[model samples]
Target: MVASIHPSLFDRMVKLRRDLHRHPELSREEHRTTDRLVSELERLGLECQRPLDTGLVAEIPGASDAPTVAIRADIDALPIHEETGLPYASDVPGVMHACGHDAHAAMLVGAAELLMSRPEPPPAPIRLIFQPAEELGIGARSMIEAGVLDGVGAIFGGHVDRHYPTGTVVAVSGPVNASTDGFRISISGQQGHAARPHETVDAVVAGSLIVMAVQTIVSREIDPTHPSVVSIGRFEAGTASNVIAGTAVLSGTIRAQEPAVRAHLHRSISRICESVGQLHEADIQLEIEEGTPPLVNQGPMVEVARRAASEALGPERVRTMVRGANMGGEDFSWYLQEVPGCYVRLGARLADSAGYPAHSSRFQIDEAVLPAGAAWLAEVAVQGGRELATGMVDDLEAAGRAS
Candidate 1:
């Protein structure tokens, strides 16, 4: 079932991906990228709408009222400067396709072309979402707010991973990514000369203590069975070497796989900071900003993905996760909260030792997987449509029997 993409389509995908890579744009600033996508989609005979300033959504028509499934590809680049040195390296200064989003967008375009190339329209309707600002973890939510998923029944999104070899897919059914939240601690005290330490509340000492104590939230407060992370990324205090600092600010992120664990970490963080502040006699204020929830793949959608993957690339290449975990955050979870969906991790890793992870300046993808990814998404839509259609039949039969 899973064969290579047509030669002409594959050639177009490579060229488009390289062109996008060379002209990388930052989050919320993808005007050029969006225009490129609109042009390509329109050339394929599909009408696209630009609801936001930077992203676009195009629907592939199918039978009337057929179940709708969507395939999303983020179209944003990171702030990292290019270091890959490839001919297609980013031309934009301080911005590069470090996260494989260029490939994501191109593969989605390839998927659209593949579907259109078919002799008949899809069994189900399909929506292609080219979203921006994904690096900031707000694109998915913002797109949803703009009504991208209005009539959508199921959705699927994927990230290119360097961990596994090309032609591999991770179709896990449980929580694969963590929920991310952030915390800020502000401490106030009296300023005084360094020689007179006793005159100041010593905010630096208090903030330092808070940072060290916050570390214990994951190790001591939470259950050891669950995975979590709490790391202080920034700390600012004091203005001079000779003066005692009167104020300090600390900022960091929080991650967890379980809701209880996420809540527990938040509670523990506040308690620890407050306790340290009281113990030091410094006024402390804690602020928590929650981010996206965990990417928990629905069982049925996972089944759809797995079945489609097997049909597209063979069962041996489809890997279903069991007990492993990742602490990274993905905005795709926002869509899952509103609809049943699956988040897939396609293997784009190459054999080179210089291989770097996503968001790294040296990160690169094996271009060969572009067609595979496109084919996989199309198969999922077809299989998902058939599955839903079958379930609908079963429901009607059961209702008839009851009557």
Candidate 2:
């Protein structure tokens, strides 16, 4: 299936990917990245529109005015120094395309090129969304606000996963990613000398207890079958070794695959803090910042995506997430809330070295995945568009029969 892509187009996509890698930009600051994409997309005769300050929305008109099937790719970099010694490494200091957004954008551009280069127009309209600020988990929402999904029937998107070997596409039909929420806990206690511990409340001890208590929320309270996480990534307290810390701060992320579980995790955290504070006779406060929702791919959308994957790559190459749902957060889930969409994981694992995780300084992907990923995107958009058109026709026929 990969051999179907022209060698020249593949080379161009590789060049574009490396160029993006060399000059990576952070979220909402993808001006140069956006410019590069516009240049490439416009070169294919696709009319592009800037719906936001740093992202683009372009369309390839179809044979009819059917609702557009949107294909999205995030174009944001991370705050990590490049560790890979490749010649095309990031030139910017303390910034890199650690999460493969460069590849995503390039593949999406390749998909656009392929779609436009076809001899005949697509069966239905296609919308290409080059989005920004996905790392901050708000880009999709902003694009929706800008009317990107106004007439869109279904959307398709994917990420480059280093865990799977290149050529495999995970197009499963259930929960793929979890909701990400952040929390901060503040505990206030009376300050005193370490020798006179009886006279004052120890915030460090209370904070420690709270941390250990929250860990039990998933293990004891929630069902073992359900996937959830409450982790305290940061804890701060105590200015001096001998001084009893009067105040402490703890912050971390909360992830859940179900709404009931998400709410339960939040409630449990608050309950633990309050109970621990009362036990220690200290004041405790907790603040929760809600983030992206759990990304559950609709069954019908997954079927469309799976068929597309099978067509783009062989059926043997189409796979599902071996390990249950991913606990990481994805803002693409925001789009699923408004309309049906499927977000798959494109295998981009490098065969040479044991791959590093996304957001790592040494993260990398197999360039071969670019063409295959682009092909999958193109196929999915066409199939999704056709599905929507067929369903619309069926609905009309049913109405006519009733009348």
Q: Model 2, range 1-403, lDDT digits (tens) per residue? A: 3537999999999999999999999999999999999999878988889999999999988876778899999999999999999899999999999999999999999999889888988878999999999999999999999999999989999999988879889988878899999999999998899999999899999999998999899999999999999999999999998899999999999999988899999999999999999999999999999999999897698999999999988899899888798899999998899888899999888976445788889988999999999999999988998898888888889999999
lDDT of each: 0.87, 0.93
Kindly report the root-mean-square deviation of model 2 from the true structure over all alpha carbons.
1.5
Off by over 4 Å in 2: 1-3
Q: Can you tell me which runs of candidate 1 are displaced by over 4 Å? A: 321-323, 395-403
Q: After best superposition, candidate 2 residue 212: deviation in angstroms?
A: 1.2
Best by TM-score: 2
Residue 270, candidate 2: Cα error in Å is 1.2
Worst 10 contiguous positions by lDDT, candidate 1:
319-328
Alpha-carbon RMSD to native, per candidate:
1.9, 1.5
